[model samples]
Target: MSPVRRGEKLPIYNRIGVLRAERKMTRAELAETVGINVQSVGALERGDNYPSLDLAFRICAVFDLPVEAVFSRTEFGAMSAELYRRPDLRPEPQSDPGGAR
Candidate 1:
């Protein structure tokens, strides 16, 4: 049986790291503010792990950002085109903010 990969391509959300860098915050300080362990905060920044919804909320609150600003949902058709490098693989053209192809 073939293995099934689930979930959208979770494009990296290093916004946490961006926030930390902008604030010149240590991982320990950020973790303390977010009520998570320093290692968890480090992992999230490094993209070594994905955040749970609860953690996402906490991080967003800490950074004072709406969730959409911090995270993006992948559209499968876009992922397919990008991964395959085949423009023909894209879905019926939608209104793209990056400008229509």
Candidate 2:
């Protein structure tokens, strides 16, 4: 990846809001845990601010997840869709041929 020049801001997508909701954690809680202000958490969630490498690692640590899981350069899809995806490779279940109860 090329270095970002001065005054160049790249949009970073994140799943902090979803993760927080899943864990029942508030913005204030996450902020306190990560040593930042609650507003900063909101900004990060809204994609209005980019987190430093240290901040990203700290945030990931709070959820016990890797940085990639929390933050991504590309937008993420629906959590439910990702979690409950049915693979086409799996074969359908076979039923018994004999009439047995």
Instruction: Give the clashing pairs for model 1.
Output: none
Q: For each candidate, what is the lDDT?
A: 0.73, 0.94
- Report how far residue 76 has shifted in candidate 2, in Å: 0.5
Question: What would you estimate as the lDDT of candidate 2?
Answer: 0.94
Question: Tens digit of lDDT per residue, candidate 1, span 1-99?
Answer: 435457545555556776677779889998998788999988887778888888788888887888766665532233335447845565786687988
Clashes of 2: 0
Model 2 bad stretches (over 4 Å): 1-7, 89-101
| Top lDDT model | 2
Clashing pairs in 2: none
Write down the TM-score of every candidate.
0.58, 0.80
Off by over 4 Å in 1: 1-12, 73-101
Per-candidate clash tally: 0, 0
